[model samples]
Target: MFKLTTAAAEQVMRAAKEGGTEGMSLRLAATQKEDGAIDYRMGFDAATEEDIRFQSEGVDIVMSPEDVPLLDETVMDFVEIEPGKPHFIFLNPKDPTYQPPADA
Candidate 1:
């Protein structure tokens, strides 16, 4: 299963609140490119019957069945890469370009 860091969860909640999607789950999708890198997308959305639902870091999440294998063991995090600049990042072992954090 995929995991979300506390920082990521807080940011997700803030975005959901600002976007007026309080009741909707965060939909996550992944696509594998020709180069074997995984592209990730996320947004607030309603869950469909074919979607798989789960909760992480107190945030609701939904994903299609096809995304399971691609996202398995993935970790999503929000970090400040530079002063006053924060961004979301995916540490996916399945992605060819993935690199382990230096501190890890």
Candidate 2:
């Protein structure tokens, strides 16, 4: 199962509220690139009948069945990589370039 850090959940909630999608689930999708990198996309969206639904940190999330293998074991986090530049990041072990955090 995919996980969302607390910071990421908070940020997603904020974005959803600001975008007037208070009741919509956050849809997450991922595709593996030819170079063995993962491409991630996420946003507020309504869940379809075929979507898999789950809850993490009080946030609703939906994804297609096809995305499960690619996203499984992935972690999403919100971090400030530089001053005043916070963004969501995907930490996926399946990615060739992915490195485990020093603290891990």
Candidate 3:
């Protein structure tokens, strides 16, 4: 299953409230590229019958069945990779470009 770090959850919650999507799930999708890298997309959306739904860090999330395998064991995080700027990052081990966090 996919998970979100505390910072990511907080950011998502804040964005949901600001975007008037507070009750919607955070929709996630991942597709593997030819070279085994994963591409990710996300937005607030309503869950459909075929969607996989779960809660992580108090935030609701939805993903299609097709994305399950690609996102399995993935973790989303919000961090300041560069000074004064924060970004959302997917730390997916399944991606060939993935490297374990140095701090871990």
How high is each candidate's TM-score? Answer: 0.96, 0.97, 0.96
Residue-level lDDT for 5 in candidate 1: 100
Error of 3 at 44 (Å): 0.3
lDDT of 1 by residue, 1-104 (tens): 99999999999999999989998999999999999999999999999999999999999999999999999999999999998999999999999999999984
Q: How far is each candidate from the true structure, as Cα RMSD in Å? A: 1.0, 1.0, 0.9
Evaluated against the true structure, the overall lDDT of model 2 is 0.94
Query: Which residue segments of model 3 deviate by more than 4 Å?
Result: none
lDDT measured at residue 104 in model 2 versus the true structure, 0 to 100: 40
Candidate 2 lDDT over residue span 1-104, tens digit each: 99999999999999988989999999999998999898999988999999999998999999999999999999999999899999999899998979888884
Q: Which ten residues in a row have the lowest lDDT in candidate 3?
A: 30-39
Determine which window of 10 residues in candidate 2 has minimal summed lDDT: 95-104
In order, candidate lDDTs are: 0.96, 0.94, 0.95
Which prediction has the highest lDDT against the true structure?
1
lDDT per residue (tens digit) for residues 1-104 in model 3: 89999999999999999999899999999888888889999999999999999999999999999999999999999999899999899999889999999984
Write the candidate numbers in order of decreasing TM-score: 2, 3, 1
